[model samples]
Target: MTATLDHQPIHSWLTDMDGVLVHEEAALPGAAEFIAALQQYGRPFLVLTNNSIFTPRDLRARLSRSGIDIPEESIWTSALATARFLAEQKPGAAAYVIGEAGLTSAMHEEGFILADSDVEFVVLGETRTYSFEAITRAIRLITGGAKFIATNPDVSGPSAEGPLPATGAVAAMITAATGIRPYYVGKPNPLMMRTALNRIGAHSETSIMIGDRMDTDVKSGLEAGMRSVLVLTGSTQEHELTKYPYRPTAVLDGIADVVPLVEQLTPHESVELDED
Candidate 1:
C-alpha cells in the first residue's frame, strides 16, 4: 500500500456514500466529522454514488435525514456523469431512457430530448421498478442502430432484504437481445471519477478518493490518477485486501481515522485556545 505521506498537497477529496459515510439510513462514526473537517478546511469535495435512482437534491435530503448534512451540489451521481458525457458527445441528442427521475432530470438539465423512437441513444439507469415494457423498448431501440448507454455497471445493489438488480444486470439483458453492449459511465470506469473531479474544478493529481470497495471505488480512483483510500466499514473487509492485485494509497479502519488526516494532508492554520 502507498503511504499517506505520498498524497501530500491534496487539494480536494471524494468519497463513496453508502458504506463510507452512511449505512442502514444512519451516519457512520466520524463520517459527519470528516465532512465537517473538510468544510472547515475549505477543501473541495464530492460525495459520489453509483445509485442513479435519485437526483442530487433528493440525495441531499436523504443524507440530511441520515444526519450527514451534505449540500446538494456536493453530491455526484452516476446519472449526472452519464448526462454530461452524452451532452458532450452528442449535444442535445434524443434518447430512449429507462430510468427514474434522477436519470431523466439529468438529461433534461443537459438539454437532451427523451423519445422512444428516432433517437440517438438508449440510456439505462437504476430504478426500483424495472418494467419489462421499458426493457423491451430499450432493446428495440438498440437493435435499430441506437447507441446503448448505462449509468453504472453494478450488477446488483444492496437492500434491506438482499441484493437487487442494478443497471449493469439490465444492460446485460439488453445486450443479449440486441448484441450491442452499453457503455457504462460510472465506476470502475475512470470516466465517472474524472467527470466528478472536473465538476469541482479539481485535478486528479491533487485529489484523493476514499471508498470502501476495491473493485469500483479504489480502481476508479487509481485509474483516474488520484490517490485512493479504502475504509473497512463497507463491503470490502481487511482480510480481503490480499485478494486484489492493486492496492489503495492507504487503508484505515473507518472514516473516523480520516478526520485527523484531513488537516494533515491539507494546508491549514492553527488556532490557539485560551486557558479557562
Candidate 2:
C-alpha cells in the first residue's frame, strides 16, 4: 500500500520483540526486511520488551541465534527499567528479589544490595524455579514493610512451545499474599516509556510506540504523550480493537507496513511529520 497524505513518518520507533519482531525462535514474517529498511534509512529505533528474564545483552544473543542480529545497546527490557527505577527510588537499598539472573544482576548493577534482612524493596519478575520458600520469603519481606515492585504485569507470554506464565502472575501472587500493590516498570507504565524515549534521545511528539498490546504498550505511549501504533501480530486480534479502551493512532498487520510508510519520506520530512 502507498503512503497516505495523512500518514506521518515516525522519527524514533519503539517496538515490542516477541510478536512484532520475532515469534519464539524465529524472526516474524517481514521482520528482518523491515529492520533492514529502517537501518538503511538511518532512523533511530529500539527494541523494547517486557520480558525480564534476560538482560539486553542476553536478549541480543538470543535474537542473533534467531537470525535477528541487533546491538545490545539497541535493546531495552523491563528488567533494565525496573533496575533504573529502583536505583532512583532507593539507591543501594536491600532488595528481596523473586526473579532470575537478569533481574538480580540488574539490581546489583544499580548498586542495590540483594538481601532478605531489612529489605527495602521486594522485586518480582519471571522465575523459572519458584519454590514455596521463595514465595514465603517474598511475603515476609513485603509484610515487614518493604515496597513491592514488579517488572511487568503481563500474566502470560508467547513461547515456541506455547503460552507460559509471565512475571505478572508472580507479582499477583505477592499482591494477593501481602495486599500490597507494586510499582510496575514495564509497558503500560509511563516510567518505562519515558526511559525508552530518553535513551533514544527523542521527544515524545517525535516518537512512535508500536506493540500488540493495548493495555501496556499503547496505553503507555498515550500516557507518555507519544504517538502509538498497534500491530496485529501478537496478543491483540483485529476484532478486539473496537472493545479496547485505549486506542492507537494507527493499526497495521505488522512492522512491514511501517517500512513503506517511512521509506516514502526524507529524513527531514520524517522528523517533521512525527513532530506533528
Q: How well does each candidate superpose onto the true structure, as a TM-score?
A: 0.95, 0.91
Write model 1 residue lDDT over 1-22, tens digit each, in one string: 3353442467899999999999
Q: What tens digits encode model 2's per-residue C-alpha lDDT throughout 47-83?
A: 9998888888889988888878788989988998999
- List RMSD in Å for every model shown: 4.4, 3.3
Q: Give all candidates' CA lDDT scores.
A: 0.90, 0.81
Indicate which candidate wins on TM-score: 1
Question: Would you list the clashing residue pairs of candidate 2?
Answer: none
lDDT of 2 at 81: 94
TM-score of 1: 0.95
Candidate 1 local Cα displacement, residue 82, angstroms: 0.3
lDDT of 1: 0.90
